[model samples]
Target: MSAESRPAIDGRIAELDDGQRRLLFDRRVGDAGEVADATRALLALVRSEGDDALFDFARRFDGVELDALEVPREKWGEALESLDSEVIDALTRAARNIETFHRAQLPSDVEVEVEPGVTLGRVFVPLEAVGVYAPGGRAAYPSSVLMGVVPARAAGVKEIVVCSPPGPDGMPSPVVLAAAAIGGATRLFAVGGAGAIGALAFGTGSIPRCAAVVGPGNRWVLEAKQQVAGEVIIDSPAGPSEVLVVAEEGCAQPAWLAAELIAQAEHDPDAAVAFVTTSPSLLEAVRRELRIGVAATPRREVVAEALSTRGALLLAADHDEMMTFAEAYAGEHVVLCTRDPRADRAGMRTPGTVFLGGASSVAFGDYMTGANHVLPTAGTARSFSGLSALDFLRSYTWQELTAEGAAGMAGPVATLAEAEGLPGHATAARLRGSKAGEETS
Candidate 1:
């Protein structure tokens, strides 16, 4: 939680038994009070100063000058058309896969007659428009774009808008534009951080307001979402990314497991990548794999910072202990690299997502595994979920009643309204009752 702790570092790997390591992650997974002041200051700027504040933060954090926060529509076509055919093809394939999965999640209208003559129905309607934030922190994020926007499209939202921070050169990345286009984003923007969230929340000159915002960023983004959530709906106040790997006796290769852990840690300095196991030999093997694999990463400093801060090699007494630890951690992404993730999912209840088996790695779920990757992070998996098509739609209930049905229910309706001490409501109910009684008489 110290200011000294937030900066980047490749964490030192030590040979700690599972008990000691599990204890370390348990403490690190919760809120770090030290960052509260920093997050609060950033949010205040977004609320009062608006666009001006965003530009300043853009300049300060991302080192990019911003003439405009909104990316023109024409650029979307240009990016989609200009990208290499091969890369586009890959994204197209992934899009179809992701879309197919999400489309299946769409809920249809339901009609039911709960009473003898009363008919009640439910309808699912897409939101008017939505904004999705894809963080380009320390790297490009085409995958984030696909993950954020595609599901909104699948839910049939009309206007899907996206925002990501500009580069040091003051321009959005071509890959982000291209991916969003494939996922059916109607517009794109250069906005990033809390100011971007504010624009989406309150509307600005260029960035039109959105009904809801979905994506993951630093604590600033998370805090911004919380501050403006009352004005507009937000998917969840996403925090740092995390992954908890539950390793069984027949878990995958230790090196491969380490790669999965490393993939999660690179998202942010607060990223938590951990493994809970019952075998000391497996724990040692995972360490060796982490050492060798981490050496090859360009983002080794970022991964190391995460590991030292939150990464753990928990040694559990048994499977029950592993489950207990995993549920308590409530990881954003739970990877069961064991022989059977399906069986494991039945017992684990806290992850935003469960990736079963080695073949279904967290990266697969992050990209083309057909499951959404924009999941709740920090320890919020206890009460959060990943982004989905359902997040972009609102459902409403409709009811109708025949004259006879209305007459039959008017007395009860009036009684209840009067009992609740609402004369206006009671009068309305009685007026209907009188009319229906007259027709019957």
Candidate 2:
């Protein structure tokens, strides 16, 4: 299909026609029953068979016969030594920025007195172990390694485990190893897909079980994560990569807007991209620029498929309509190419990450911007958040009360407990109240 023939919705999003609404909002990431069943079987096999299951799956799925599952600690140093100086420098610098950013996210314990002699507070505790899964099927995401590991390390996680699908040589990409080392992963495993998640969730003899598993991957990885959710904490279910570019006339160059859309579209065939604007001329110019940009890209087929299917060109009636639609869409990446991007961002509510101005490219955020790239997708930005140091930490609240505070709370507590028909709870509160009153008297 031609670029002009791609999906387009015009008018106020609130008053969209049935077909237009469906086009704009019906992009649900439905679960494939077959995929779920396969993932369940894979997880069961990994749980029942352990290392043998990993080897079998490695050969069956990854097409590599692995002699061992865990990549040796020594190989990380060797990988760094073998890599080009430029690649090493880039990974090292990116790791540094990522650590610096997440270190700032480390939360402090909060305490406050709600009333006289009554204190309540929450303390943050880091998980002891975490699993970072770097996808190696479609591409080597060394950046994902940093995104997952650096945050956990900064949050004070002691055992940061890394897992990735083995390459043709039966090991993860050397760049991944180097990133793991730079990010301070304590262990590395050459495994991937549902099986890798299973190993991390269930803990085989070779790969230690983790308290949480994170990083983005294909559908199999997502399905596996969902199945093992209660066993270990998983990040938000990642859907196809997506971005929404909200622009105004003359605010951003048409080529720059088109490039942003194409950059997100190139991620996968199912990835979604949309350009929303109030200016008809700007929309047309972006359509034209997309035609040129899509033709020039090496990933032309993937970009074209994405743009033709899930991509959209939405023309809103006004700035209010544009921003309303943007908030409703709640896209994973929202780029505001408006006159005042900051003001526009301040009014918005549900964007995984908002890139301000034409100069703030999503590509920069994906790599060296120090902001984590692992973000909620499939409209999940409405409630979910991007992966961060906070995800690796659990918080618990504590309460301390003086005798007077206990006596003050007891009457209300006992009354509520009696109203709820829990006589035992009422008696417990009354007994505490009596003891505290007597002590204070």
Candidate 3:
């Protein structure tokens, strides 16, 4: 499709039942059989080809091939030394902010008295080892490295591992290495794509199988996580990034309107950005801002493609209708840069994270806002939460009953077991109760 001819949705907001609404706005990728077939091929290539397959595919797909499967440990120092000092300073500052926010997410020890002489409590402990996938071929999001690692460290994860694809230079980006060091990653692996995920899940020659893996990646990376998930835990398998901006006339500025849409669309060609506005003037102003602002961005092609393919400008009767659509749409990031996020938080039931007011952009939350960027996409946020310290830890419940307690409950247990026709279960419960009573007497 030509750029100008890319479908742009503009229509009156109408109330429809669940079935009708779904047909109109379902962003499910399974609906596109071609996309699914392509993904299947991507998965097949990696599983059959292994690291060699990954290298060839990366060259063909990302236009880069790497020689080293691992970044030399000494590169950590060189990466730091090579960085533009100002960028390092910014990353350092962002790391501190991210650390502070995630630290608060650290679970506190809880002990409670559920019953007399029964101490019921819970303990929070981090996983022994974790793998964080950092995207390397496209661009170095040093911020993403910090985003995944800081929380794992704050949660007291013992062994933190970093993995990413190599750069054009056939080495992992110096920025990624530097960020991993700053973020507290204990080890680094040069391998990326599905092979990296497999190595993390199964443990290859040099690397060990990680207990859980977390971070964002392309479709192949996402599929790899899903493939090996049973062997190891994984964060949500993400899809194309999306944003829904609910704007009101009073708060709507030209810059805010254009920036919010372009920000999400620039991430991927298939990504979507929608502006649901109630004001006609605000809509026109948004168009003007997009025309000017998009021209200035380095990633204008990506932004343009995203806006044209999946973009929308839905005219609503009022703010309530705008918010209602947003809830039903379930954006990965909802920029409620309007007035009060809390006032309408009840209206927003599905956003991964709410960036309220103009002070905080979607970028802020992704980089240093302490909120996890590994959020559910494609309306999955309705049931999933963004990644947090909890993602790095596991919780379990254990119970210990007193001998007297066991004896007192034995008749009920035996009765239920007998009702279920499990004679062995009933006998075990009865015998235990009898033994307890005899000992007590």
Each prediction's whole-model lDDT (CA): 0.77, 0.88, 0.75
Q: How well is each residue in 222-260 modelled by candidate 2, as lDDT tens digits?
A: 889889998999888776789999999988899999999
Report the C-alpha displacement of residue 273, candidate 2, in angstroms: 0.9
In angstroms, the error of model 3 at 201 is 1.9
For model 2, give the 10-residue run with minimal summed lDDT: 3-12
lDDT of 1: 0.77
Residue 75, candidate 1: Cα error in Å is 3.2
Tell me the lDDT of candidate 2.
0.88
TM-score per model over all chains: 0.89, 0.93, 0.89
Q: Residues 1-441, candidate 3, lDDT per residue (tens digit)?
A: 235423266555764455535533676554455544555665565556555665676576556666656667789879999999997888888788877888887877777756543456677788999999987654676777888888899889999988887766766788999999888898887767766777677665556668998888766677677777787888775667788888877775768767888888888776767877778788777777777777888987887877776777667888788788888888888887556666877566788888787666888887766677877777878888887888898876656656666676679999999999999999877776897554864
For residues 340-384, could you state the per-residue lDDT of candidate 1 as single tens digits?
668779887778998888777888777787788788876667787
Mark the 10 consecutive residues where model 3 has the least summed lDDT: 1-10
Instruction: Between candidates 1 and 2, name the one with more favorable lDDT.
Output: 2
Model 3 backbone overlap count: 0
C-alpha RMSD in Å of predicted model 2 compared with the true structure: 2.6
After superposition, the stretches of candidate 3 with alpha carbons farther than 4 Å from their true spots are 1-7, 15-24, 30-67, 109-113, 117-121, 435-441
Give the Cα-based TM-score of candidate 2 against the true structure. 0.93
